[model samples]
Target: MADPLLVVPVREGTATVSLRLFRTATGDRTAVAFSSPLALARVLGPGQRWIRLSAPALRHMVADLGVTGIVLDPAGTLPPRSPATGHDVHRLRVA
Candidate 1:
């Protein structure tokens, strides 16, 4: 399995922080900084104060913040795939 994807963004003055959980075009989930692609582009596409990090790095950053397990896999949450398509796709969790 590959590592979870992550993005980190920091806002000015007010100390705004946003973390987005994303599943790649593939079926794995990653915690990114922006909630959506447009959001990320807004922050990163422009000159913003932020740094991208991997899942492990993110876990380390919040290790001391009393965060427990953050699961990303959608094994039992969604409906099973059809044998006809045979594609391994994980559904995104829409809020």
Candidate 2:
């Protein structure tokens, strides 16, 4: 059977958007995916932007980047709240 597509979280950079990888408690690099949008939202929140990719595709895309694992339907763990409340800026620098 063909690999099924999964919901993968992504983030935007200064000039391009890319997959958002994760680190385990022990500092292992991993790519997180979800079986469905609902599952993704449950962990990453409703406003998370994502794209569809099969597990195999994700593995290939991240292989060169040192990502060694894929986490499906990861447990939701909200980051500790920061006293500061604002969005971080992302801008491209010109040489």
Candidate 3:
């Protein structure tokens, strides 16, 4: 709570960034944040963009949207990928 958390922002139609919200298994809206930038990249991948925000500020911002839960430092939803590894390299052909 003391340290500012790394937050992922989403721009829907407009350039203004808004806190990215997630859906719980039970259909509830929750906000997600990471304790540090490294933690964020570990979960959302290195190229993922983010913003810094305090816990209180994050909660307040989400509360307006009826999101009452915050998930902090959650584990990666998927494995992290890096271009340096070239594991994601692929080829495409024109039709």
lDDT of 2 by residue, 1-95 (tens): 89999999887657987887777655677778889999878776787779999888999998998876787887754442222642321111111
Compute the lDDT of residue 75 as modeled in candidate 3: 63
What digit string (tens of lDDT, one per residue) describes model 3 on residues 9-90?
4323256655556655565677777777787777667776678887778877877787757777766354333446524211
Alpha carbon deviation, residue 59, candidate 3 (Å): 1.1
Predicted structure 2, TM vs. truth: 0.77
CA lDDT of every candidate: 0.46, 0.72, 0.60
- Where in model 3 is the C-alpha error above 4 Å? 1-14, 78-95
Would you list the rank order by TM-score, best first?
2, 3, 1
Error of 1 at 21 (Å): 14
* Residue 15 lDDT, candidate 1, scale 0-100: 60
User: Best-fitting candidate, measured by lDDT?
Assistant: 2
Predict model 3's lDDT versus the native: 0.60
Q: Which candidate has the highest TM-score of all?
A: 2
